[model samples]
Every structure is written in C-alpha cells, then in structure tokens.
Target chain A: MSARAETLPATGLRLPRLGLPSLDALGAWTLALIWIAPLVFAAWAAFHSPRDALAFDITAPWTLDNFAAAWVAAPWLRYFFNTMMLVTTILAGQLVLCTLAGYAFARFAFPGREVLFYLVLLQLFILPEVLIVENYVIVSRLGLFDTILGIGAPYMASAFGIFLLRQAFKQVPKELEEAARVEGCGWLGVLWRVYIPAAKPVYLAYALVSVATHWNNFLWPLVVTNSTTTRPLTVGLSLFAAPESGVNIAVISAATLMSIAPLLVAFLIFQRQFLQAFLRAGIR
Target chain B: MSDTDSLDRRRMALYGWMLLAPALILLTTFAFLPTVTTVWQSLFSRGTARRPAEFIGAENYQYLFDDPVFWQVATNNLIYAGVTIPVSIVIALGMALWANGHLPGRGFIRAAYFTPTMLPMIAAANLWLFFYTPSIGLIDRIAGLFGIGATNWLGQPETALWAIIIVTIWKEAGFFMIFYLAALQTIPPDLREAAVIEGASRWTYTRRIVLPLLMPTTLFVMINAMINSVKLIDHLFILTKGGPNNASKLLLYWIWETAFSYFDRPTAAALTVMVLAVLGLVAVFQFRGLEKRIHYR
Candidate 1:
C-alpha cells in the first residue's frame, strides 16, 4: 500500500537521478573496503619492517626480511608437503568411496537400501568435529595417531560427497546404462563407462570443496598430529604465531601470507570456478 | 523360475552391499561408532593409577554442571551464535542485494568480500591478532587520531567476545553472500519488473517479492552458520585462547581444553554429547523444515 506514496512523485522537490544508485554503490564499496582491510593490512605488514608496519607509514621502504625470518623459523616446506598429502589423500578416498556408495544408492535395488542411505545421511549431523574425543581415541587405538592418515581418515567417507554424487548419478538417463549393459558389460563396467562420465561436474565441485575444507582444517589435525612431521600449514602457522613463541607481528604476517598464498593464488586465477563450485555445493 | 528370480535378487543385494561396504565401514569407524562410544565414555569416571575406571553414570555430567567455567563457556557460545548467525546473514543479504544489482566495481567488490572465505580461519585469526593487540594495534593507531586511548579489544573480559564476534562476521558474511547471490540469480527477473511496474519502491519490492523467494536460501545458510558456530573455534587459539580468565571461551574450545589440555576425557565426552544433542535438534529441524520448503518452482 505504501507503494502509492513512493510512486506518486507528487512532491514538488525533485531529487537528482544520480542520488540513490550512487548511495548504493557507496555503501557496497564501503563494506567491501572494510571487509578487505585486514587482508590488505596483513600484506602491508608482511612487506614492511615491524615498526613501519605498525605505524601504517605509506612512505615506509618495503623489505623481504620478514619473509626470510619466517621461512627460517619453521619447517614450512614440510608443512606444505604434509598439507598437500593430506588434501590429496582425502580427496582420493572420498572419490572412490562416495562414487561407489553413490552409484549403489542411485541404481541398485536392494534390501535395507533406504536404511543404509539414512545412515549415511546421519554422518552429516554426527560430524567428526563434534565427536573429536572419541575419534582421537579411535585414531590412537588404530595406531594411526600422529599420522596424516589419521587426520584424513574421518573425512574420507563424506556424506555430502555421497549425497551430491547420488543426486548427479540419478539424473543420468537409464538408456545410457542400458546401452552399455547390452554390450555384456557388468555393473562396474556400466558405472565406469556411463555413470562416471555423466557425473564428472559433480565430482569436480565436490573436490574443490573438499580440498578447500581439509586445507583449512585445524583442530582435528592439531589433536592427532603432535610433531612437525605431520602438521599441516594451518597447525604449523598457529604454532609459529603462538604467543609463547614470541614471534614478531611482521614475521607472523609473512608466515601467514606464505601459508595461504597457494590457495589464495589458485582462488584468484580460477575465481569463476571457485565461486561456481561453492554455489554448486551450497545450493545442495 | 521363482527359485532363479530369488537367487538373482540375492546376488543383486550382495553386490549392492559390497559397493556400499567401504563407505559404511569408514562411516561406522569414524562417525556412527564414535557417536555411540562418546556417549558411553561420558558416563565413566576418569581412571588413574590408583583406581580402575568405573561407570559413574551422570557423575561426570554433574561435575560439568557444577563447574562455573562450563556455564560461562556455554553462555559465551550462545552469545557467539546469537550474534554471528543473524549479523552475518543480514550483512550477506545486503551484500548480495548490492553485488547482484547495477553497481560499478562489482567484480572487485565481490572478490574483496570473498577473499576472506578462501583464507584459513587460523590465518584470518592471525591477521586479526595484530588488529586486536593493545596499544600498538590497528584499532589503537586509528583511535589515536580521535584522542581516544588504546583499548584492549581482546585482552579484557568485556570486549574480548565482541572482538571475536566481529572477526567471525567478517569471515562469514562474504561466504554466506555467495549463497544469497546464487539464490538471487535463481530469482526470475520478471518478478522485479512486475513489482516496479506495479509502482512498488525498491524496499517494497525486496520485502514483497524477493525476501520470500530467498527464504529457502536463508534457511540453508542459517543451518550452516549454526553448525559453524559449533565448529569454528580456530580463532580462539590465536586471538584469545579462551583467556583473560575464560571470558571468550566457546563450547568447542572448552571441549578441546577439557580433552587435550586438562586431560579429562570423560568431561570432554560429556561436553561433546551436549554439542551433539544441539546438532541433532538442528538436524531434525533441517530435514523437516528444509525438505518441505525447498521445493521451489
């Protein structure tokens, strides 16, 4: 009903056409700046001397000493290797496990199928994060504690991955599977030939999400891995920046930037794909 | 013929189970079995060299309830969730409306917003650690311009939780905006045209046509944010360590402390059970509420 008052335009005062849209743009840019200021400041601090960094001195001479100091302080290369191994191992496991389980749920007719699917879905709620205490115990009991495998094991059989694949697989035409089966193909062959190709996009989306997630995962890995041998960049960076370590802010910024640089660069380069993958994952 | 059919059915069932076996085993090992064992472990007393562990049903829970730190942490978590979820969602909604609109520098704005989501929470926390440091920090440097003294944002009990809340909002709003943006794209453009043609103001258009359409997305984001409030405690390690006397301590942080730092497994298990109970309630709401409302045309 108030639309009438807004639409009337009956008031004698005429505002500039540029007024409202410019106001909106102003608001957007402000929020964007505030949102990004911390990161920008971190980049600034990483490049400048510690005193100059805190001073916010625009004329300060840029230097690389902080990066050098940070690099020498920790075994960052080993941490990167561990993180890479952890991400790759988890993705590979999720791919194999979710694909098989998803195909079974999508195509197979079996007893207790619904029950099994619900059980898989239950994992969505009973996440490893919440059950950390027992998961730690289980990891220790299985003699995998302090290993990358222990860090990666709980996340490998992801319900979200399975659910996404099942949805993707179910959308494939039955005729395609029938065509493959007519060539005397077994179930495995049909899945390999027909189903996997059809669900490739879903796999890509799930992989992007899984990689980003495990790369940033901290608490479980922190609990499971005690030494530099198994620490991911995240846990490693946390330790490097710990208050007890007494690392200077500038050096911590450098280490922080270096640790996130790979993902950040990948995100910038494949910005479209990253956003699309998040959208694809989020909507489901 | 019937005998052959039954045999074939059995073979198919067996094959299906084999395909599902790997995932089920992992899920059982990690998710299902642990959930049961966490509950079971919570009912026991901590065993020391002098005594073997025995089932002290409800005693650990009693201890948790009696501990004032538990209550403080729980309350802190509630405030954290209560503040972060709606604030981030609202900011995200505003961001989505702007980015999805006819704004200049839209791509740069969107990128600036989303870059935080790509950073690890620990990295974000590290960056903010400098911002929140007393006296020589960013906030103090800026406040100096206004003749205001350096305030200890993360060092004091009063403002420490609020400081953490601000960082959480910054990290999350942009991520949540992606969902809102996706939802906005799916909103048919013709509806906006119709609303404008009907003499509706921009605000009216959003309230009448857009917000209702975005309800499912909002619900989805709300559920994710709720889960995140429970899980996203990485900042506590860097920013506060639940410190200044447990002022900013959250539930998950406390659980980690109880389990790892304090070496009290039973108490930690009890806290985990409580978190699980909260999550379970959310799960039911999501399945029931989301499943029905998500059938958008």
Candidate 2:
C-alpha cells in the first residue's frame, strides 16, 4: 500500500492499462495445449486397440479393448479395492485426527501447546519418503507389511492437514463456542454443536485434497507392498509397466490409464471444485 | 465430586490425547521411528548373503564418503534440483506474467496450463518416454522438422540426466506457476499503472516495481519447488530408475535400491537419514533468505 502511495497517481487514474487481451488469449490457448497434450495422448493411447497402435495412422479405430485387455492383464479389481480401502481409511483417520487436533489448537487452554503443535508440523518439512528405507524395517517389525492398514497408517495425520484445519478452526468465532457453553452445554457439546458444523467447508476441502493425494500416492505403497493383492494403483501400474522384457507401450499406457481412471473421471466431474481444492493445496 | 466437573475434566484429557493420538502415532511410526532406525541401521555394513553381517560403525557412511557412486548420486540430485527448480520457476513466472498481464480467455489458459499438475506421474507414465523417443516421438518430431538430429536422450550417459530434467521441469512449472499466479494477483494494479505512466521499460518496471514486491512469493515458491524436487520423484522408477550406469540415480532411488534390490536395509536407512539432513540444510537456506526479504509475513 505504501509503495503505491510513494509513486502517487497525483491526479490520474488507478486502473492498470490493458493490452491486446485477444493476443494473450491466443498465446494462452497454445500454452494450454502444450500442457494438456500428455493427457490427450494418454486418452488416445487408452482408447485405441493394440493392433492399431503400431500403425502411424491417426485414423485408427478406437476401442475399449485396451481397457478390456488392461483389465484382464492385472487384477485391477483388487488394486482398486486396496486403493479405495487405503484412501478411505487414511481420510477417515486424518479427519478425526486433524479436526480434533485443529480444534484443540484453536479452542483450548493448554501448556506447551504451540511448541507441541510446531513439533507436529515439523513432519510437514520432512516427508516419510525420505525415511522410507528405515520405515520399511519398522513396518516389517510391526508385521504390518502387505496389509492395507500398513500402507495407509503412515500418512493418516498429515501435518499439512492439521495446519489447514487449525487455521479453519481458528477462524470459527469463539463467541459461538462460548454461547453454547453458556446455554448449559458441556465442552464436548459445545465442540460438537459449534466447531464441527462451522468448519464443514474446511472439512470438505481437506477431504478432497486427502483423497486426491492418497489416490495418486506411489512411493510409500511401493516400498511397503510386495504383492498385487495388497498394492494400490500406482504400485500395480508400476509392476504392470515393468518391461525389462521389452515393454509394450500400448499395454503400459492401458495400465496407466486404468490406474488413474477413477481420479481422472472424478476430476472431470468436479473440475471446478477440484480447481479450488488444488488452489488451496498449493499453499501446502 | 460433582458429575459435571468430573466429566468435564475427563473429557478434556480424553480430547487432548485423542486429538494428539493419530498424528503422533503416524508421525512416530513413519517419520520419527524410521529416522531413528535409519541412523541406527547406517552404523552397520550389513552385507549380502555371501557374508554374515555385523556392527560396522559408520563404515557405510565411511564408504559413502569415499565411494564415487555417492558423489555421482549427489551430483545427479544437484543437477536434478538445479535444472528443475530454476527453470520451472522461470517458466512458471513467464506463464503467470503472460496469464496475468492481459489475457482474454485467461481462465481457459490458466486451466490449460494447470492440466499437467492434475496428471499423476503414473498417468503420464510413459508419456515422457514416448515424447523423448527419437525421430517419431513428439519432441524429436518437432525438432526434426527443423532438421535437428535425433538426440540420444535417455540412452547416453551425458544427456540422460538432462532428459529427465526436461520432463521434471515440464511437469512442475505449471504447478509452481499457480502459486506465483496467486501471488501476482495480490499485487495491486495501481502501482503498475503509475510505473507505466512514468514510461518505464518493461524490464525496468518488472525489476524495480514488480520484482521487489514479489520477493516473498518468489522465496516461498523456490523453497517449495526445491523440497518437492528433492523428496517426491517416484517418476524415476518409470523414466530412468537412476539409469545408464547410475547417471540419473537419485539419492532416494539409491536408498530404494539399497533396501529393496541389494537387501542392504541398514545402509538404506542411513542414506535416508542423510537425505533428511540434506533437505533440512536446504530448508535452512530458504528460511534464512525468507527472513531477510519478508520478515513481516
């Protein structure tokens, strides 16, 4: 504000000058095409049959055969089940953990709270992937290896999630909580009646991010899981793609497409909401 | 002894621990436990089945110090981080500048640029490979039309890492640009107008007026870009696997091999601890820089 004042507009306008907006629009379209080309390619590859893929022809007939072949090539059904189970478990855990943690940070009177909170947030700086090698042993020791819970358990309470929810919880009016307290409500009652409902948008926002992130997750599941039976989509796709025996590009593309299809469909269906969710996620 | 008071106190204790439980458990198991174990494990030079393993106290790190592979891995990581971070930032800034400047159908453009960020590395798994496929592949096809040779991108050791760097830059630039775009919007338009009226050169306006104002955002974006690049590069599994004589082998991938392929779990742990330390050091540089520029925030 001060910087703008220092160069005071004296007696003139404040509006920034506009250039050729349409020219920019053209450039924008070109750049957007470059960015989306890979996605377009994957779509093209996934829909085309294997035989047509070899021919350098744009006029190849599209089919669901790749999807069908991809489906039969691996246990995509088991992969989906494991991935869904993993995501759901982790999201449910994070919501409960982050919400309560966020609430405690926002509402309570406690000693060394900020210190403890910062300690938890430190995990945000250090990713579990950096520690995956050691974590492999830890999981092995716990006998949790190859279990869906083992895969999902490690990321249940993200520091980012806690931080986001805490910010949202803090934004909820303290007066509302106090009013509930004054109306003969107990602390739990006040929290239930006031805090949770008020922070619903944040809850939804966190859920979308959690689901998207966990669905797309690879490294942790890669290290922990050894079999397709328990592996998520990323692991399944990687294992399916491992072509030390000369990879079939079309089939690999088919596997890749199948692996990410659910999320891709979800994104297209909820593009606007997904964009907002990502806008918030970028802050993380 | 009143029921209300007792229940209140009990509830308070319960909520506190309950709130703390999942995060603490997950963090302890995943972050803290592995870290601690990695440090312990690094102390042993636990060998292959050919040799019985025993306590070797810093020998793995000792080898890591002398072993040229570690240095190569370190160099590759630096190269990866170096190319991916700054190039992506520049591309992101340019995209944002163009998108922010005066774009009609900006929403369409913004969405278009951001489409890559939405793509899972897995979804675009073979996309880069195919794009880098010489002669007929997309990248070379464009280059070929201009009479450029089909460069041995991933095959040759010299250009292998650079090829990976290009893909990383492409994937990440759009993602980082969003943050810059967000930051750019926060800049008031009036300042630009005033600068324009002064007949400032485009470079002069950006350098004097826009750049200083964007210092904090730039710093934040740089830190994020650096951290993400260092930590979460599972794409290497598909693209290179630290390949062509470990030329593209990253620290994380090295740790991965140590644990899984070689079955040297202990050294893998130690290397992980090293990765954490290296990343922490990077964060320190970032934090100190941010302090100087954007202390208020």
Q: Which candidate achieves the best TM-score against the true structure?
A: 1
User: Candidate 2, residue B91: CA error in Å?
Assistant: 1.5
Instruction: Looking at model 1, give its docking quality level.
Output: medium
Chain A TM-score, structure 1: 0.93
**What stretches of model 2 exceed 4 Å from their correct place?**
A1-23, A49-55, A245-247, B1-18, B47-53, B147-149, B196-204, B285-297
Residue-wise C-alpha lDDT for candidate 2, range B1-297, written one tens digit per residue? 599987876677666776677678778888777667678778876766798767888888877889899999988988888878888898888788776654456666766676666666665657776676666566776787899988767777897788778777777787788777777777787776767678776578778877788777777788878887776577778877878899888888888888889887877777777888877787568546645655765
Cα lDDT of model 2 by residue, A1-284, tens digit: 75565444321223234463344456657877887787677668667765565443579888887777677888989999999999999998888877777777776655567677766766866787787776777788899999988887778778888888787777888889889888999767877898889877777777887888788788889889988779998888877786473656777777777777788778767877876676676553
Docking quality tier of model 2: acceptable
Error of 2 at B137 (Å): 2.3
Can you tell me the DockQ of model 1?
A: 0.53
After superposition, the stretches of candidate 1 with alpha carbons farther than 4 Å from their true spots are A1-21, B1-5, B290-297
Each model's iRMS: 4.4, 4.6
